[model samples]
Target: MTTTPPHTDPVMHAIGLAVTEARGGDPAAARRALLDLWERTGVTGDPLHRCALAHHLADLHEDPAEALVWDVRALDAADALTGARVREHHAALSIAGFYPSLHLNLADGHRRLGSFAAAARHIDAARAHSPALARDPYGDLVRGAVEEVADAIARRDRAPRAPAPGPAS
Candidate 1:
């Protein structure tokens, strides 16, 4: 007898396809696809899909500033979800586990925009929410990025400031 694979949410499936397309070299197309999905979902879509779409959209932006906007939206969407809703969407996933990555992305976006204080705040949030596992590749990547950004901020602080030019003659 033939058997079918387990069911996955259609929204989640579309997100996976869009993300794959984005990674395959047509970011614009991927962005368009995601936007379409977002419109279809409207304000009442599952929080999980909203969060995932916003997160992916942030990465597709060319400007870090624009990316930050999407990142904030993603965080807001995630925050709107309750633990039970999260469990309903994906039994294996926890809402708490999503925060670290969201914060890490925010930190990176802020760091790219030279907002060291904001970046540091998000980095701290990421650390606070990170899983206790000894070795998660995603966690390690986020930690490494955090360290790099921290060092960059430190160097910027230590660098001598150039004297401001007086009024033009």
Candidate 2:
């Protein structure tokens, strides 16, 4: 007879399950389930879950600033993960987290909200994550544009600010 593995933390399991559901288009249930799972697990400080929940919530709300926060959290979690599966998860997230699809959505949202800088940042992040764009003809063009935008942002950020004048004569 085959033996089944023991179940892990119920709340963590529920959060994972909730994320799956959210990805499948059940936003309401996913949100409720994630909140319940977090409450039950007392997992507010878990960077991974925090990031995952934040990203999914941002997606549901079309909020790039929120999503950006989550993305940073996710990167922190990735750095701390020590398991084999964690490595795999990190690899996947590193590639998928800044995918053009989501980045484009964020850019559009930011643009509509009059956040040109945020929109540009997302495009830059998306391109940075897509280093292998040469393999995809269409993606290469999009990546090229993203690089240009990033360059422009960098130039603007680097431009020298005028020095303050002396206080008194």
Candidate 3:
């Protein structure tokens, strides 16, 4: 899984902590915590929680195919999210801004699986929606990832990206 670092909203504090744990090198503990939260959230629960949980969970997996499953779930939940709902958590965020990273992660996963056609399609979507990203470091990070994934797809490289959060173990 590859995406820009996630944005933390006050309402998502628990998730933020688990994500921090994942980044801090305790993936097993983080995964357990996240899964517990996922259970509480339920399958048809809040789209925001579903999106964030699936997105972060995807990055904890070492298998590309497994990561892709969570990425797809994240995208599905993202599609159900609304701007109003996102704004409830953080006024600075828009649902549109989430697409680039979501698509980027999917692209990277597909690229690693040798699904270049799908990878190209998703990379194109990521680029097309990238202008919605803020003119800040967060935006730069996602855009940079978009470029890297695109490059990898163009070269038909299936090897994982170095230091990639998931799909590299």
Winning candidate number (lDDT): 3
Q: Residue 137 deviation, candidate 1, in Å?
A: 2.7
Candidate 2 pairs with clashing backbones: none
For model 2, residues 1-169, the per-residue Cα lDDT tens digits are 2322213434345666776676676868877776665455343465445544544554444344554554444444434444443333443233343355345445444544556788687766676567644455556655654555455454544222221122110
In model 2, where is the ten-residue run with the lowest total lDDT? 160-169
**What's the lDDT for all of these models?**
0.73, 0.49, 0.86
Candidate 1 off by > 4 Å: 1-7, 132-134, 156-169
As for TM-score, the candidate ahead, 2 or 3, is 3
List RMSD in Å for every model shown. Answer: 10.8, 13.8, 5.9
Error of 3 at 106 (Å): 0.4
Task: Give the per-residue Cα lDDT of candidate 3 at 133.
Answer: 97
Greater-TM-score candidate between 1 and 3:
3
Give, for candidate 1, the lowest lDDT window spanning 10 residues: 160-169
lDDT of 3 by residue, 18-66 (tens): 8878788899998899899889998899999999999999888889999
How well is each residue in 34-67 modelled by candidate 1, as lDDT tens digits?
Answer: 9999999876777777898999998888788898
What is the lDDT, from 0 to 100, of the residue 150 in candidate 2? 56
